[model samples]
Target: MSKHWKKLPWIIAGILVLIGLLNPPLLPWILLILVSAAYWFLPRRGLIGPVTLPADDAFLPSQQVQWWYWTGHLFTDDGRRFGFEVVFFSFDAFVIMRDQLVQAAITDVNGQRFEFEEFLRLHLPKRVKDGFDLSSGAGNQVTAVGGDGHDRLHAQIGNYTLDLKLDSTQQPALHYGGDAHPYRFGGYTYYYSRPKMATTGTLTIDGQTFQVTGNSWFDRQYGELFQAIRQGWQWFAIELEDNRQIMLFDFKGNDSSVEKSGSITDANGLTTTLAAHEFEVTVTGEWTSPNTGCTYPSGWEIVVKGEKFTVEPLVKDQELRANHDLWIGPVYWEGACGVGGAVAGQAYVELNGYCKCLAAKLP
Candidate 1:
């Protein structure tokens, strides 16, 4: 047995003796040890038998890819707005490891991008005690609150001199794995978010200054297993004209099966979940990337059950393929979407990892 396992008996015996001396509960302590030993050494009755059912091979891969991610949009009292996106990607194999990237940009109606980048390094805290209450309701759940009375975050890239605060008033609704059926891909993820936030700050990019004012969106997702060869995904978070919010993600598989995914959060904080079969998202336009020699779906026609919407590209050639070998880097799309039965609002779309070389596809 390992050193830790060999010491277990001695440690338990010592604890029993100490407790017996402190109080006249020696009989109870002795009985506890007997029961613990039976559970530890017994075969079928042991505590390590199995808690969860052994997942099939198809499900095991996703179980291994787990991480924590959170992204939120903040809106200030004035017209100024900021967006906060944070993620902690984790893995088990040496080839796979925990990777984190955060991106924050300020854009105005004038088409200026003031951005800041930071890489997360520290571990998330374990518990919160004393004077601490988790900020919940709307869809926001407090995952970790440091003892120092503030959430901790690290910056990896971009501007070095930047400071910001977390606003609890704008917390979104809380939807846990229990609230909805677990999203099954390769593994499972406990995803949640604090959708809208208000950020007040000035970001200067490349010696240019732009004042930012708008609403932001935050998303948090952590799981062990994720698909590697999936063609691409298109995600949309739109704040509609009637103050309702909608989020849509469409994942395309290699077999040409489009997994239409999305969620609708009403103003009353209730969520109407949408699955792949329940929605229709189609690419209406295409942009070929000269850098990667791949074609991307630049425009889209999105029609949810009982609702119709369209997405048009703001910048069709917004591909970062040269820097990153992925086609879903960054682009802008602005279009109007009709929600529910009547209200129509302007929407934005973000597409990532949409292109793979023809050679990459050929055997």
Candidate 2:
């Protein structure tokens, strides 16, 4: 794509915003047209450059949005288990400025406790070379930085402090078939996941610390995400006992239709894309958050490749209510679950756009 052609969308958006500001009565109509156009055009595959690992894993400020996410299950020497999530997000507010936000959470399965914290900051000169170096909160309370699948993660919230090192064991599973053209639910994104990562870390709470070993999942996605988030999504990453990893996505459009897609990685690091009819998920129960009053689906019965599995949350109240302060804050459920029935494994599920309180305010 030429430089001028690449700038067309933002130029058109700026014009639309100006027109909306000049004519107050047309703002809603303008937004409706923008959304409609996005839905109609974005799903078609886009052409792009080769996507290489360890380098493309770095921050791409050129894109409008990007995020590095990690979710894992850890255990103590005895038997206690825990789930942890740490994500760093970067959203382009302008051509030269970006909004950086970090969210960290820990679910103490044995203790039946969930604790999380959020931090938001602004950075100028949208540029990050080589790899990602992200931190949030005062004195860097949360930090995650690495290249490829070898990474370090740290977070401190409430009485829990987690530090872990992750080493990749398998190749990344590229979603939407391949990197040549990757688009899902009306948006273009270079999405891939490192599903098998050997994790070693320490969890310190109160005054004691325990050495932990487990597995972690790494996801890196960037590109057109503004339209995708408006449509809600339920994402799952499951690591089975037989060394197979599956990543499933159920995206709901603005018109209330559901689109499903996924990728499965075998023990030998081979990944294949799944068609819509190859997988299905049914909600078995619901849980209402006391803090946000959002009713989220609790238990799920997932059928993949004709095999049935039941997934139940380790902690029901894993909702994270964002403390809004100049960034888009939406309450979301990112939690750990155990898989049974046809498979015995661990999974992480993320549910977004469930709470009307903050979701309705998103752009």
Candidate 3:
């Protein structure tokens, strides 16, 4: 039975019992109220419990396994653009983005068509500081990383669809952090992997196939409240021409106070956390969104401790605004960056919502 459907019987039974106990000849209305309260307040016992995995599971190495994510943005051209993101241990994943009033379709690896239509909406029991708890919308995502060294993915959201295969031969470096000197994000997130994935497949949009050849960055983080409202960040994941990679992020809060920021991983999985002043991020350009009327930092200048590198945008206008909202997310100026003020390698810099101001708080 579906998870949501299973809750219906208990809810109906509670309502019926309350009605019966409220009769005129009953002991009292207060007694009925107390009984109802007991039904609602009793501890949940049975199969429901926190999810757990064995420590030595084979799939434990990949953080992407059995995880769900949401990347939503409101694009002006469409109104609302949302994608359901999921990565499986098998390397199969999918991303589906679409707007209302449209029908989308999903095409699998073999070019098969599947109707992708569904919506899952639920209200929050409490309000959030930045935004309402809102609902976790409806979507479908499936991925599998095969033992033969290949990744497959399929996703469906509204009328959009995304299916592709990623080459797994190019393994990513792994890194681990502990609470003593944990990742700057605050929570315990198993961070690892390559900064880029060479993708070779087709990305179909509304029945049209666009040949795709691009690099994708994959990150998996699971923890409670990894970031606070006061903390603004600037992040960069650069792929160098020398086949090396650089990943860094800095968190800054009020009074220009540096909370915590640094490069957590290097090319070969060796880890290091740079001091606040060891790295710097300077915005070189800005772009304003016509939809949300919000301006985003479009260009940047990055200096990494003793290492020297520069990054620029390939497509600065890569703005996604759908569902009558605006999300000026980073698409980036990525390419081979000169490292150590001499060597060159692939580089990409991301200036998040903080581009509006140093102390800008996100909504």
Candidate 4:
């Protein structure tokens, strides 16, 4: 027991003794004191203990804030390409809290899209086993980093199904404080990312199954409370042909100025930290979403070490209008891209909070 807890009984006894000495409603004071002490001392066993890892990398489940995120880009043997995101979010809020939500989506360069989101409340259909796998009844979603440190994922929505196996060639990239220091991002989450994972699996779209092989990204963030409303971020992940992975995040302030940071993990699993002012991101063009009229940065010209790179989307309309509570709870654009210039690679870009604090803009 903590020192504070050890003194609790003495404190309660002292209060009761004082009330009896004063001779003021002894019976009521005794009853109230006993009830309060019992309530305070009662054990509130939880599913998880002290955080063994930050929100992004966990060895055990969290009772507070948690989410399992997986996103990837794959190509068929015939050069047809696709992208997908399977995520499960769980957190508790004093109010305005939905227990959990499973969001899954798949997109193709040919303009085919499929998305499934289900809001869960009191009886949210989900299970977190060993803090590594998350299984949800929402569209049969599962995102797990198994003992071998590979991601096994599956999701089905109508005629669209994403079944992929992701093997981590590099160690996890810790973006912020790990378990020892969990004060970042509202003191809730320790964040990390698997910038690139070698992926192979079957993707069924519109009843057509295709064998695909490509790279994907995995991000995990969990904590007691992730108060992201302070502002949002522009997240980028790039995987070079040489197996080098680069990731950058521009955390935006209310006025839109960005705080740039991220990491670069080499092919050999060595990570070089990128601090603020180490890099810059600039938009080369914009795309106005026909669905919500939200203008998003379409083409990007990102610069690092005085070298510039240009990236273009596989499709201009990769915006996910997840207006429902079951999804990201925000309107944002997440898509695969073709990178050129300084690095030849495939990339993924996520743009959020452009219209407001996390997808508040709508038609």
The TM-scores of all predictions, comma-separated, are 0.56, 0.83, 0.54, 0.75
Task: Give candidate 3's TM-score.
Answer: 0.54
- Per-residue CA lDDT of model 4 for 330-361, tens digit only, reads 66788878889877888888886765334343
Clash count, predicted structure 2: 0
Q: Report, for every candidate in turn, its global Cα lDDT versus the true structure.
A: 0.43, 0.83, 0.40, 0.67
Could you tell me how far off, in angstroms, the CA of residue 92 lies in candidate 4 after the best superposition? 1.8
Q: Which has the greatest lDDT? A: 2
Per-residue alpha-carbon lDDT of candidate 3 for residues 234-325, written as tens digits (9 for 90 to 100): 65666555555566765545554345455545455455656667877766677764434556666666676666555554434333222212
3 versus 4: better TM-score goes to: 4
lDDT of 2: 0.83
Q: What's the candidate order when arranged by decreasing TM-score?
A: 2, 4, 1, 3
Poorly placed runs, candidate 4 (over 4 Å):
1-64, 94-98, 111-130, 138-148, 177-188, 254-258, 323-328, 356-363
Show model 1 residue runs off by greater than 4 Å. 1-88, 94-98, 101-109, 112-171, 174-185, 206-211, 228-231, 254-258, 320-348, 357-363
Q: Candidate 2 residues 92-157, lDDT tens each? A: 745465678789999999999999988887652123455677788568899887777789999998
